[model samples]
Target chain A: MVLLEFSMSPLGKGESVSKYVSRSLDIIDKSGVDYRLNPMGTVLEGEWDEVMAVVKKCYMRMRKDCNRVSCSIKIDYRKGPKGRLSSKVSSVESQLKRKLKV
Target chain B: MVLLEFSMSPLGKGESVSKYVSRSLDIIDKSGVDYRLNPMGTVLEGEWDEVMAVVKKCYMRMRKDCNRVSCSIKIDYRKGPKGRLSSKVSSVESQLKRKLKV
Candidate 1:
């Protein structure tokens, strides 16, 4: 599962996140990789190689076209027996459990 | 780094994918989990815990509130030297390279 999150000024304000997402989505669509974007509309998918190449393209396009741009990419591991949790959270119930235990 | 791809019928079509995405985004936001959604508005983020529980919630909510629901999830590893690639593609240049190399 290769997940890429690129946050930057869009190349064209008239340009859409969906369009950029589609750039990646097009790869995913053909790769038969199951994927969908976020609401603010970034791209996410599962693949086994060279996901950063796509991110690099996004950066290049945005840099060449957008006025100002900054982006970061995060890739994670989620499979097998340990796929249950995303992380430890600050939930009230969890907090209570910890505090009560303490 | 954990990647989760959930392609399920959303809870409320009239409610909006952004809304459901926002729910996950809310958790992500609090977790400092950086994420953005797809254009159609699904959720994507980076985290290192039990993400499936969240998906479980979405499923439960959609099942109760929406008409019908189906969901599939994908998780992968992309956070190391190997993270550089998503996968091999059937590109012309790559094919050309193969044939030329041969």
Candidate 2:
């Protein structure tokens, strides 16, 4: 399984961007993928192709209206394991003996 | 200051991608931006334009040879303060009362 976390935004869209972010979230919600949104970015877990397709769709959606789009993605590809979205943090928290500020 | 963590790789380049990663790192290093390389991605701390320019350079370089390229970027834009690349982790470490496995 692969855990992909990404953030995409359009440049020159002014300081407030919740409108654009909301649009992207709508696409992600409709994709039916397991995802968790954090302050920095959204984490999605699934097959590589499915996950990437979602990102591609979101980028396309953003690109349609904006001239310059900026996207940042981070992928953690691991074999034989799934659900690293929470597990990874739990593992670290277990060592730290407390909950982390997510 | 903005803290940008990004990972870029060329798809269909087989498993080991140290060569491409090294090339991108060379560009980032030459850009003279303060950055730290971790297992997941590289965190760069600098002005928004400067940091993003480095990422653009890396993406363009990867696009030169590879037909398909994948990049993930997470950005934290804060009004004031620098050195978040280490200080962010250090803040958590301080609360955890120990060093983290960076």
Candidate 3:
């Protein structure tokens, strides 16, 4: 499974980006892929192409109105592992000997 | 190399998390490892242990003062390759036939 976390924002769109972000999330919601939206960014779980397609759509959506957009993406492409979204955190929590709410 | 993108926020600490995040960044800045600070989260680049240590320190730092802390971490562990920070985006831009400022 491949997990992607990304943050995209429009330049000169001011501080609050909830409206634009919601529009992007709307696209993701319709993509039929599993995802989680956090305060920092959105985590997408799927194949590499599936995830990147969503990101591309989001960037295009923001670019329609905003002149410049900044996107930061971190990808975890695990070849033979699935259900890593929660397992990754479990690994960390096990190491720390504490349970995380994430 | 391992690239970790994570956002940590103290729950019930109000809307702004810059202060708490600054403390976390201070720990990272002193870790002698390469890192980047963005609006959404911080990216740390290093070995697995090195990156996780910084995250542990940040979590502990926030846990000291805040009862509940939410941390969202996305890790990209690439083996036998380096300088992925820029290259990853380059690959995407190449596929899209457009350049991204990130």
Q: What is the TM-score of chain A in candidate 3?
A: 0.90
Tens digits of per-residue lDDT for model 1, B1-102: 455545455644753343444444444334443332332223433553655666666666556666865565555434533211122122322333331100
lDDT of each: 0.42, 0.74, 0.72
Error of 1 at A81 (Å): 44
Q: lDDT by residue for model 2 over A1-102, one digit each (tens)? A: 998878788899886555676677778867998776544456788999999999999999998899988887877888867767667655544554554334
In model 2, how well does chain A match by TM-score? 0.93
Name the runs in model 1 displaced over 4 angstroms: A1-102, B11-32, B40-49, B79-102
Best by the lDDT measure? 2
Task: Identify the leading candidate in terms of TM-score.
Answer: 2
Clashes of each: 30, 5, 0
Residue B67's lDDT within candidate 1 is: 81
Ranking of all candidate structures by their lDDT, best first: 2, 3, 1
Worst 10 residues of 1 chain A by lDDT: A83-92
Mind giving the per-residue lDDT tens digits that candidate 3 earns over A6-85? 87878798755556766777787678877765534677888998999999999998999999898888775667766765
Off by over 4 Å in 3: B1-102
Model 3 residue B25 CA deviation in Å: 15
B14-85, model 3: which lDDT tens digit per residue? 755557766776677678877655434567778999989999999988999899998888776667565655
Which model scores highest in DockQ?
2
Each candidate's iRMS in angstroms? 14.9, 11.3, 12.5
Report the error of model 1 at residue B57, Å: 2.8
